[model samples]
Target: MSTPPPRRASAAVASPTAPLIGLGAGAPVLAFDVGGTDIKGALFGEDGHIRCLARIPTPVAGDRTGQAVIAEIVNLAGRFAEVQPSVNPRALGLVVPGHIDTRSGTAVFAENMGWKDVAFRERVSALTGLPVHFGHDVRAAGGAEFRLGAATGLRDVVVVVIGTGIAGALFVDGRPYDGDGLAGEIGHAKVASGPTCACGGTGCLEAVASAAAIARRYSALTGAQVAGAKEVLDRSQAGDPDAKLVWKDAVDALALSFSHVVALLAPEAIVVGGGLAEAGPALLSPLTARLDEYLTFQRRPRILAARLGENAGLLGAAIGARELMVAGGTR
Candidate 1:
């Protein structure tokens, strides 16, 4: 799993203005998660809960592209302020995926969104007149895992996401390690040995094991289009030959990638999330069996489902924003 290391340490004490702290006691942060298809915005209250959450389809093309995303977030900020006009939010917390340089607040690149080197933090901060705390979506999720979720209390764990694409967040010593700005890129790691990837590589894990890859490979083999990885899972359960082969291939490739991670990081647990992880036993039981069959010397880590469901990224974004606000002396 390619996981982003944490950019900072978890808070020593939760503050009144901290993102997930006060819940029913105080105001909430305006949180936004930018994605390829939609932008999800919500008010994450101090009590560690979400309110007024909504989604808007992302606009495509020209200057409206990036600004459109920012605009939705700013509008959400306005709504948050209007609802609790007495105490306004002083900052925004945002989570985005793909090659983000969190330190620079720049999206270095996002192949799915066709974005590059966009100073997203500055844009949002300028538009809202509030400081922005930005985080890589997967990395932020890892932070949440380390501080509060499945990977909590574990010294070393890998959080692997099998979604439209595959990626991961790593936690070591209860903190994320970025390796500069290029640490986690597990999805792009070579795994298939021959298939070409959209990132211009051959045999990338994303090419072989991601949700898109499962559907694409099934289509290529059977000349029939499947809805997504879930449909492929259904067909596999029904004993369809092509579906079985496709699903098996995905598991095998993912196991190969995880093996590499195990060899390198020695994480105590591997937490799996995303659309494919919803498969539960269909993915996990066999994956564990196969990995055990493949390795000899390495200590096998527990392969478990993600506890946070689809909201992990959003929750993580909230945490990242809170940490930033605290660090900046806003709380």
Candidate 2:
């Protein structure tokens, strides 16, 4: 008994306009993420500069395919208004992962684009008249790494991305914590012990440390065939004892899910980002020595890395559609 969404069945009413502030004041906030293959789109420009970035693909599921992925971002906002007609890009921001209810812009579920409860900001502001801003792609890249990357000033953070599937985004003083929107779904929480997880959960942490579960658990444990997850961190840097036991069991299940999110959010830092955090320091020196051997009394945090690569959820959906144009609500 909880369906009623499909853009409120076309009560379509979008023209309220409101969205513009900073990034240099209007004419370039059209970011979109919406994954499960692709639909990236971008245009940030008011000198903060991103431009017409594109991706495409994502259109196979059902229920009018979430208004056909908002009519392909209203045809990529009419090709970003004919490939930048002097950059007067009104305003639109969107990021999507799953279960987002950010104050009813809906999309209550999205298991890899098989959507449900979809309103997606009044059908993308009624087909791109603009003012769309919606979120939850890893809590808008953990609110763009707590406002400007790598847990900026850091006051209780937890960005985590570990991509091809894995999620994060939590913060306290720097803000972003949305418990009512089901706080950062921490990649389905459970720290893997068996398998099962397509969010039906069992041993989650994205089914044991994601990057497509370390290339499907090292091709289901050595039947050969490897490609992604940087070739299991390049055959565990060429030593290769089954790629160092699947890179030490995906960095000890991501340092035991960062020691249960640093003993339940005492976060001072934990940024890490997608594409296996490019295994820098072989993935931060053994995930800081297995998060200091899975902490004892807490206070650890400081894991860092993600300095907004892959456009940090399109610059946090253009800073949340420039914060709904600084709260005038799509003014």
Candidate 3:
């Protein structure tokens, strides 16, 4: 093992104006959020501010995808070091999509990225010569929301990211409930029948409720080849019949899935985010109404939109890095 850098206590303290408390408030840190197409990297300084940030295209290396990503991370780290030579990072936080096993520090599977059982934490630590914290991207974003976004102070909440695919971060009793890193696969939960999903499942929640699903279904129904879900939403508001039908189905599927979650977990809040969440009230109002239809005896959760925007996952990764030095994170 390589020699570890000199340790320093974390100095991050959550402030009212900012969602993050003490980020790289000590020995500095590197954080990365790896998406299927892009990788976002940031460096945090002793004062907990982002000292450097960059986004790079994710390499398409087939079976070598994992190695390629690790190389990119190393390159980003070196770039940050060049930009801030005075800082010596003590830890690195990394997050990626799909099923994750944080306990094992592995990417269990990511269909889009074409990788499985990739031990990211061990590899990154070995290459970077620093302690590495690994996590799921959606869950990391949810952590940011829980500590610094919409669900702050909520003990029981579900932070659902509704972009290309639907996934969730489960918080129970004010602590993240990872279920061994697979508990938040709410997207795969069966909702309807017919129409196969990318995971080879039929009637999965993500197949019907996700932003990608909305656009795909609308394009199929109307044969109009819309640009994205936002366009479909706009058409629906403009009284387009096909767009309305697709949008309603998407909302209904979401409500059905959310109602099941409410019945099982009874979360105090359901914080929605990601590309679809940009619809704001247009999405939440109808979903809430449909959810109410299914919840006759269960407690209705307050459905709120995420406030942290696109940077939540990166911020959460930074939090994971800072947690290595801080006694209690989000303080």
Order by TM-score, highest first: 3, 1, 2
Expressed as tens digits, the lDDT of each residue in 109-142 for candidate 1 is: 7777656788889888888877788888877776
RMSD of 2: 16.3
Best by lDDT: 3
Superposed model 3: Cα runs more than 4 Å off? 1-27, 327-331
Q: lDDT value for candidate 1? A: 0.76
The best-first sequence of candidates by lDDT reads: 3, 1, 2
Q: Would you list the C-alpha lDDT of every candidate in the order shown?
A: 0.76, 0.76, 0.86
Expressed as tens digits, the lDDT of each residue in 70-92 for candidate 2 is 88778777776686777776678
Off-target runs (Cα >4 Å) in candidate 1 are: 1-27, 62-64, 84-87, 329-331
- Give per-candidate clash totals: 12, 4, 3
Supply candidate 1's per-residue lDDT for 32.
77
> Model 3 clash pairs?
12-22, 13-22, 14-21
